[model samples]
Target: MMKHQIARVLVLVSIAGTCLSTASCQKTDPNRKETIPVCGEVYVDGQPAAMLQIQCHPVEGMDTQQPTITQAVTDQEGKFQLATYEAGDGAPVGEYKLTFVWQNFSAVAASYSGPDKLKKRYADPGKSPFPLRVEKGKQVDLGRIELSTK
Candidate 1:
């Protein structure tokens, strides 16, 4: 009877430890903010700006929940899907200062390059004129954004 009781206690302790570890792994912080899907298209010189990165910076007074920045890369069709914590998971609903960057010089040369295409000013978030607000549970569509060299 003593041996049986000891075995039962060991089993219970193992189960309790497993349960605690599993719960801890999936722990959620109270400070975590909700996120929504954000989608947009980028255009340069009236054409699709494919394979470019779009970084969304959290702006003060616009993002009261959390200051988590999100980013997405444009597809071949100039479409992008924003991601915050995961791939294509979107971002927290708030206003964001958008910055565009195209670092792939080889890809740029293969696709299209002109005086109206690559503009360095558009890559600076502080100097960029693009500002967007993402709505919760709603898809925000940023229409054709033209970047001009002039």
Candidate 2:
């Protein structure tokens, strides 16, 4: 269920945010108004990062200067939904940047138990960073992004 949702969101991002003109997705029904879910998942050392702050921003000069639009934080299972407006009123299909930031408490940092000392530091400071791109109406699966606390 979780993977399915993520796939859907990734698809939309690909369709709407791709930079290449060829990245555009063909409209089978151009006169319809529909909203689709573009989901995201964040993981750290094979574990889901819950409640991380994630935002979607346009690619600056490449498209409309729409500020970063944040999506709901990943749930316990690292699942989140990216909103898509009605067909014609949707985001101006173009490039986008996805950022994820999260805080990791000392208790959690001490649990990684490995050669990831830097990861401990950043996670302890509640500073996690990872960037992904969106392609408007296509799924651009970001897969897993690992951050270094150091």
- lDDT for 10 in candidate 1 is 100
Please give, for residues 28-142, the per-residue lDDT of candidate 1 as tens digits.
7667777788787887767787878788876663455455668998888888888888788888877878888765636535653434245566777777688988887788777
Q: What is the C-alpha RMSD of each candidate to the true structure, in Å?
A: 4.9, 18.1
True-vs-predicted CA distance for residue 63, candidate 2, Å: 7.2
In candidate 2, what are the lDDT values of residues 6-120, reduced to their tens digit? Answer: 9999998887677555545554456333333456576756677765655555545432332323344567877666554431133334445555556542455543233432334
Task: List ranges where model 2 is wrong by over 4 Å.
Answer: 1-36, 61-68, 84-92, 104-133
Query: How many backbone clashes does every candidate have?
Result: 0, 23
After TM-score superposition, the amount by which residue 43's alpha carbon in candidate 2 deviates from its true location, in angstroms, is: 1.0
Model 1 earns a TM-score of 0.70
Error of 1 at 41 (Å): 2.8
After superposition, candidate 1 runs with Cα above 4 Å error: 61-66, 105-117, 143-150
For candidate 2, the per-residue lDDT at 18 reads 71
- On the 0 to 100 scale, the lDDT of residue 121 in model 1 is 69
